[model samples]
Structures are given as C-alpha cells and as structure tokens.
Target: MSPSIEKNNNNNSSIARESITEQVTINEKLNLCFPLESLTQVRSDLINYSKINDKKLDQGLLSQLMIDDNLLCRYMKRRRGHIEPSVQFIIGALEWRHSLGLDKCSEETFPVELFSSGGLFILGHDNTGNTVLHIRVSHFYKIPELIGLVKQFVMFHMYKADEMGSRSFPLTGGWVLVFDCSNASLAQGDPEMLAFINSSLKNYFPAGQKYILIINLNWVLRAIKTLAFTWYPSAVKNRIKFISIKQVTDYIPLNELPDYLGGSVNCYRSIPKNCTTLETLRSNGSITLAQSAYDKIIKILTLVN
Candidate 1:
C-alpha cells in the first residue's frame, strides 16, 4: 500500500506524519512515524523484557520507560523497531545518564560565566511550540578550556527540554537548536569538544532534536559544517538545514528572535542573573532559565507597548 503522508498543521515545522498499511517510514521532515503494529509490539517487548531482566535494569528506569510512549517509540524507531537492540540502546542511554549524574546537574555544576556568556540560552519557542536553543559558536571559542563544562551545560539544556516536553501542550519534548556561527572561525572547532557534542546528540537525545538550523553561513562555518557532517549519523544529519539568518523567520517568528538574528527582540539585557538548580526546577515546576530570560524580554516589550 502507498504511504499516506499527512501534514501536522498544528506545527510550524510542517512535519509530515505518515501512515501506511502494515509499515510506515520516516517522512521528508525526518519525522519518526512507524506503523502502529511495530510500535505496539516493541513497546510490549520492552515491558516483557523488563520483567525478565529486572535485575539488570536500573531501579526506576522500567517504570519511567513504561509510562513514556514517546520515549519508547523514539528508541524503537532509532533502532528500526528491533526489540532487543532497542532495549539495549535504551539501557545504555540510562547508564550514560546515571554515570554523568545528569538528573542532578544544575547551574552550580559549572562556572557562572557559562550561563552569563550569552552563548547558550533558551530564546523562545518556534512556530511549532518547540523550544529554541540559541548557541553562539563564537562564544564557545573564548573558553576552549571549559569543554567538559560546556558539554555538561549543553546536556543540561537537553534534560530540561525533555522536562518541558512532558509538561508542554504539544508534547514535542525536544529542542530546535539554532547554532549561530556568525563571526566564528574554523579555529573555534575544538575536536575534543566537537566529538563529545557529536556523541551526546547521537546517543543521548533519542528523537529529541526537532531541527538544527545553522544560520549566518560563512567560509569558516562552511568548513566546520564540512567536517561536522562527516561526524553526524544519518538520523542526526537529516534534521539539519543550512539557512540564512533571514530565513530563520520561517521556523521562528521575528518577534521572538533577538536582534542579532534579524528579530526585533533584544534579549541581551534579559539574561537571568541566577537560576534554580535542575533538581529544584524539576520538583517545583518552575520556568527554565532560558524561558525566564525570554519572558523578561517579552515583559519589557509588553510594558513599553
């Protein structure tokens, strides 16, 4: 049977969700849509596997895994609906998170300069309601020594994005990563840090990346992309698009973007002075640091109007 690809009108990304009889495949937008039979069977297999391998599983991982259909589907899809390998992938991800203490990671885990640098933050939401993560590649060059810290910081955002996904209306639970490479040169690409980042995005964030927009293309950025593309897996590579800064308005509105990116909002002054720890934020259900900063900018804009 021919696949019936349906556009999800509610999303700004115009992601197409395809349904075919007995089988479905990844869409043009690289959306993770499979037939219900494969999804259901993989889910059941995981649950059954968990029962038999309880001793091998993390204490609460099974319960958490069972409840999140999206998470299960993501891993299953990543492994192409193979039950055993999918379970292994999920288990490996859980182990990596535990080893890294990702759940306990917080603002204090790294230097204050990391957050205040304005290199990485949550700017606003795109048209699809997915959170927009702005990463200033130029800023990263200034602190090459802090590569490990930088890795943790990026992962922390991924953790929060997942948290946000669980609570948000759309349930998309991932980030629209906007890597602003303006003024950044090829010299800024630290191989160690780049390798770490590449591994994390591929292994850790299961179906978590909504889109990766590389804006302000220059020769330097072009060189970096040439190298980086080789490092990305087919799944990760598919979601990336090289767009000019002006074209960013297609996925994200002009009003939500900062002036640097051809948006009206000036979020420079809106960076949060302090942030709640990841654990505290998780427990209290508070807004994210990035969201808080964007909110501050919006509030000021509203007041002036």
Candidate 2:
C-alpha cells in the first residue's frame, strides 16, 4: 500500500491494541467484567447523563465520578449496571453531601452532649473487616431539638466509616450498624430522622451497608420493623438481623466490641471531650483543639481489629 495508507493502518492497529489492553486492565483491577456494560462505558454515560440532566457537579465530585473506579462500580452495581439511574443516584449523593457541608461537620459543630451521651459512635470493625457503627437509640431523645445537628452527626459517621473502611477493603468496603434499642421508645423514632436514614441507605450510600444489627428490640418494635421492612429493597432488608448482645459476637469478634455488648473494647475513651470546633481551631491557629478531635478518631478507629 501507499505510505499514507500504511501509516493510517498502523495508527488504527495501535488504537485497537490500546483499547483491548485498557479493557483487560479494568477487568483485572475491578474484577467486574460485565457482559453488556464496561466501566468505561458507564463512566462516559455518567458524564453525558449528568449534562443532559442539567446536573453540574463541582470539581471534587466530578473527579470522584471520573476517577474513583470503586465508587463508580458501587453505584453501577447498586443500579444493576443501569447507566442513567446510577449517574442520577451518585449525583444526588454528591450534591446532598455538598449542600449539607458534610465534610465540614465535626465534633465541634455541635454540643458536647451529643458526643458524650454515646448515642452514636464508631466502635470497631466486624469479623469481616467492616466498620462498626454503634447507636444507642434512647440517647437520641435527649437532644430532640438538635435533630438537624443529629442528621449531620449521623451522616458524618457514615462518611467517616466509608472513608475508613475503604482504606482496608477498597473494593468491598462497608459498615455494620448496631442499633442498641434497650431503652428506646417509639417517641424517640423521629419520623424525619428515620426517613432521612432510610433514604440515605437506599440512595446516598449505595451498597455501603454490610449488615445492620438490632439489639434488644422488643416484640412491639420488631413487629413495627417488620412492617417497615417492606419499604426497603430486598438487598438492604436482607442484611438486617435482629440479635441479642450475645449473638453480636457472631458477626463482630468479642474483643472488637464494647463492654456494653459483652466485649473488651472501651469505646468511651475515644469520645473527644471539650474539643473546640474544627472551624474555630482553624481560624485561631490552634492545632491542639484540632488534634484532639483527630486523636479521638484515630483512637476510635484503631480500637477495631
């Protein structure tokens, strides 16, 4: 063939080889070799769908969408590889996090009572390496008026759990939630908060919940919960298990659990006491206050085996 024709054929061959190599690399890395939709196609579809929907993500979110293969895989798997729904779900999560200033939330943003009460805290990890989120439901009623703060507080833990778990189990990182319902009453079940949590599990944090343990739930609450289970997807509903304190050890090693749950972990020590808001610490050039919060998190996370 002529010189120009040969050059064109060589360029085409190079392009074809690069394409096949990229596909193999993605499959090996993600371990997701979907027959119909590849990761590349899903990512391209996400960008195009975002534009079509008039959803303009900020640079950080855009980067996550494009570069975080694990994140994209989670959303894609959640939606069963449906490109449009996956894009919409992730965009919604990103926008919601940005709107709530989720990253900015810390122990200092709310009263010490919230953290001190031990209503919600990251205890340790499960037997399978998932982060454990402990919630003493009764304590939630103490600060009824602080529901807004509580919402942010809960999301902060979730975001932090995802961040922490991703480090250890990058592809399949998730959290195990334990709701201690011993002294909790129906009145403490704020409709708004419950709805927020339900929606969060279904939409915001896609495929990020490995298990949900409900300890000490009375029959009445169990019946009520059975009715509520109808609203959840089977994938989510199936992960929830009702168990007593003793059975908790089946999922989480006894040593990783807190004393209240018949384990050796002393979670109370990790609670940051009298720490100033991170914002205030940043403004005043006070590293000690910030370090306290950082240390608290480090201590809490390290407690998990």
Candidate 3:
C-alpha cells in the first residue's frame, strides 16, 4: 500500500525465507549439525587433556561459543596426523568475525561434536577402499539420547565399518557395551533406551566394570572426550605423564593385550611435556584448553602392573 507498509512486508517475507533455509539441507550447504550436549562434553574433556600436556595453543575469547556447525563430520584433505586437525578445530571454533552464518562459510564443514557427542558426520572419501569408525557413548544415559542417535547416522552413512558400538573390542570379564549395527539408523528413545542398556548388561555382562568403549575416531574432525576426574581416585591422579607409543608397544608379553588396555600407561597433564608419543595418547583424552583441572580423567591403558 504505502512505502513504509511495503518495506515492512518485504522484511517479514525475508525472515520467513531464512527460517525455511535453516530447515533445508541442500547438497553443497549444510551447517555442522551435532547434538548440543554431547559436543559440549567432548570439547570440555579435550580441553582438560590439553591442560595436562600444557603445550599451549592460540586461544581466543569466543572459543566456547554455542553454535551448530558441521565442521567435524566432513573430511578435509589437508588434515594429517592427530594433532593438526585437533588444533585446527580449536582455533576455528573461535568467534567467526566475518559473520558468514555457516551455510555460506567457505571452510569445510567441521563436526566439533565428534569430540564428545555422537552424530553422523558426512566424510566424502576418495574412490578408495572404505574407512571404519565406531563410537560408543558409555555414559550414554544420564545425559541425553540424541547424541547417540545423530552419531549412528553419521557413522552408518559415511563409513561402512563405522558403527554405534558393540562389545568394547574384547574386554576380559565384563558386561559388554552392546552395539546393534544391523539397526543402522536413528532410533529415538523415550526413557527405555538407557534402561535397556543397563538391564541387558546386567544380564549378559554382569562382571564388566569400568567400560572401555573402543571407539574409532577414524575420520573424526575433533575427538572430544569427557572424563570424571572425581572418579580417578587420588592414587591415579598424581602419576600422570606423557610416554611414547614406542615405549609401550614393545612391552607386551601378555597373553592378549593384558586386557586390551595396559595398566602401566600413564596420563599426562600437558602435551608440552611429552617425552614420547605413548604418553601423548594416554593423557590426551582432553586437550583444548590447559586449564587447572575439571571433571575429566585420563584412564591410561597399561600392560602390566
């Protein structure tokens, strides 16, 4: 009708269009989508791990900004070794100054969620052989189920061998964390999912204690892990240090991996103090920020006493 009225109508129309765009997942433009809570947990754990190693990386103010991005799910060719991409995610998670609003951002989609939350990450691999990844959210309950559901989707779709998780590799005598790869899709649970996992474990793996969910971060963008330091007991806390993979790989005289994870391994507080790679892996469960100490724990798997 009038000039002001026409402008108002145009503004409303624009808002409506933007809302629809958010819902649509076009082929080339999908923001990093991950279950909110899971991502937070993993990120928090890694930050703790980093502190123990104490190497130090570039940190920014908006490092903890809550935003849904597909940064981790998709694979970038340039990423090599564990440390490089891990560091990249930390830096990229900082405040995006240019404000491209995700979909338009030129950077490859990154799933910072894989750090802690489980979700489907679309990693477009080259026309080579298949890659495998298996993720297990051990304390899948008490938090939320959406994290598991999303991860199931990403693993199934992208990696042929990737799965929700089943029996943590081969633990001695313990209830296995069951994984149903057959049902390779998101299955929402009311309250029953958590109940079922506990119930089933009690029946099948009653002896299983301290579940070591053997997850594969095969093509993961940022591997976030959350550990409860409170559960670590003081005896385990003081001996944290970085050891080399070469150090422990050869020390095995056990019948079968000494329970799949060695007990002699140590967890360090910082990466800077790493004398070898083994120590780096053991203590790197959390490493985004080198903070004092939070609710995270590094359960280093060692061979012998």
Candidate 4:
C-alpha cells in the first residue's frame, strides 16, 4: 500500500479504538452506579413499550439519555432497591414531556411578579448543607402560579445540583424548605394548593428533600396541615416541621438563613425591575441551566415514554 493509504488506515483504526474506549467507560460508570441487570431490564421494557405505542426509540435520544449525568445521579441515588423503577419512570416521563412539546415552554410566559416580588428565593444552604428554598406563600393567590413557581424553583436547583455533583459536593442534592408564612392569610391556605405542594415535594424533586420548615406557624396553618397530611404521603410527613421564628436557629444556622426568618443573613435583595425573566436569574448565577438545556432534558426524558 502507498504511504497515504497506510496513514488513512491508521487514523480510522485510532478513531475506532477511541469509540470503543468511550463506550466501555460509559458502561463501567453505569455498572458502578446501577445494577447492570436492572438497567438492561429497564431498557428492554422501554423498547417493548415503544413497540406497543407504535413509536420508535431514536438512537440519538437513547444515547443522550444514557449519557446524561443528571439521570445517572437520579438513578444512583434513588432509595435502595428502587433503582429499576426510578430508571423506568425517568425515561417514560421524558418521552411524554417530549411528545407534548412541554420542553418549549419558556419562563417568560410565567408571571414576572413571581420572582420580582420575592415569592420564591434560593437562599443559599442550611446548617446541614442542604440547599435552602424559601417560598413566601402569602404572595401567591392562584394555585397555578404557585405550582409553576415551585416547578421553576425545583428545575433551577436540579441544574445546580448537577453542577454540585461535578464538584463532588452536591449541595443541591438535598433541600431544606422554609415556607415563610408570616403574612399569609387563611384564604391563602387553600387545600388544593396544599395538596399540590405536597405532591410536588414528594414526586418531582430529585434526591428528595431533607426538611420543610414552616415559619410563623399559627392556628390557621395548624388546621390546614391536618387536611394536607390526610392526602400527603407518610414518608414526607416525617420531614415536615413547624417552627416559631425564634426557633429558626435550632434547625438552620443563623449565618445561612435570611434575616426575616430570624437569621443573620439578608439574602433576599430586591429584584431589579428589568430582571423580570428567568434569564435574569441565569445571568446572576442563581440558576445553572439555560432554556436550551432545559429543553434538551425534557426531550431526553420524553424519548423513552
């Protein structure tokens, strides 16, 4: 063979070796994080489901789902012996989300006042190092807005959690919620809203939550809790705790919490009028993923369903 022909053959061989090495590395990582048999079973189930639904699994989508770090973390950290079901659910949910084009939904469509007025704030971490999500329940009048706000907050932390995992700290892997109801009224404590909130905390958030601290708890909230827990899952009920403002430091460090919540820190700075969209949060480093990343995650998830 001529010299150029030999050189071309060498390049092709090198590329083939690299591809095989990459595949092996991925498989090894997957095996380390999940039982290979369980992973294979879940994939087989997905393939069967697609056939029954008259849908074909795109190789590119499957590849993306397999290599996604967030999905890997979610599966690996699922409750012991539940990894298979978690994989199935994550894949199926992604497929459905993709089919509905829910990935295209933008934060601009949400009410700007949700963030501008401090309805939801990612107020750093708690004493236990769990990410603190502060929700001003009084600001929300409608259930839909409340739901949207919580989803957005969760999405923001999901990305942050992924970044933290890369750094080996995983700060957003666990959460400690502070439901500041200091100014909340009885009317705002709607049963439907409470149910929705409970469902989101239980079903949506990856890695689950550590604690849900309801500040300024009163007789009205006490009454609402009775109705809310009737429908709330028992596992999450153990994590929920009501505390007076003075008792905040007992659960969270004073330096990490907000001044309004009886902590020394004042993290809730005013949102500038121009910073009305989710992009503003991204720019401030308060949010990790861009709109495209969010859409990509939804598309990946929707492929299996």
Best candidate per TM-score, number?
A: 2
Candidate 2, clashing residue pairs? none
- lDDT per residue, candidate 3, 1-305, as tens digits? 99999999999999999866654544125333333333455455546655654234223222322232232322111132133453354434321211212212211222222322332221211112122222223312222323343333332232222211112311111111212122122222213443433332222121213232222212121121113233344543342222232332232222212121332322211122212232242266412323322112222111101
Candidate 3, residue 249: the lDDT equals 28
lDDT of 2 by residue, 77-106 (tens): 777767667766777777787677664566
Provide the lowest-lDDT 10-residue window in model 3: 296-305
The residue-by-residue lDDT of candidate 1 on 214-299, one tens digit each, is 88878855766688789877967888888888788889998889888888876543334465333354245432445555455345
After the best TM-score superposition of candidate 4, give how far the Cα of residue 161 lies from its true spot, in angstroms: 6.5
Q: What is the per-residue lDDT of model 4 for residues 242-266, given as tens digits with 9 covering 90 to 100?
A: 8888888887788887777766776
Candidate 1 residues lying further than 4 Å off, grouped into runs, are 1-63, 142-145, 166-174, 233-235, 268-305
lDDT of 1: 0.64
TM-score of each model, in listed order? 0.66, 0.73, 0.19, 0.62
- Candidate 4: regions farther than 4 A off: 1-33, 40-65, 76-79, 82-84, 95-102, 105-111, 143-172, 267-305
lDDT of 2: 0.69
For all candidates in order, the CA lDDT equals: 0.64, 0.69, 0.29, 0.58
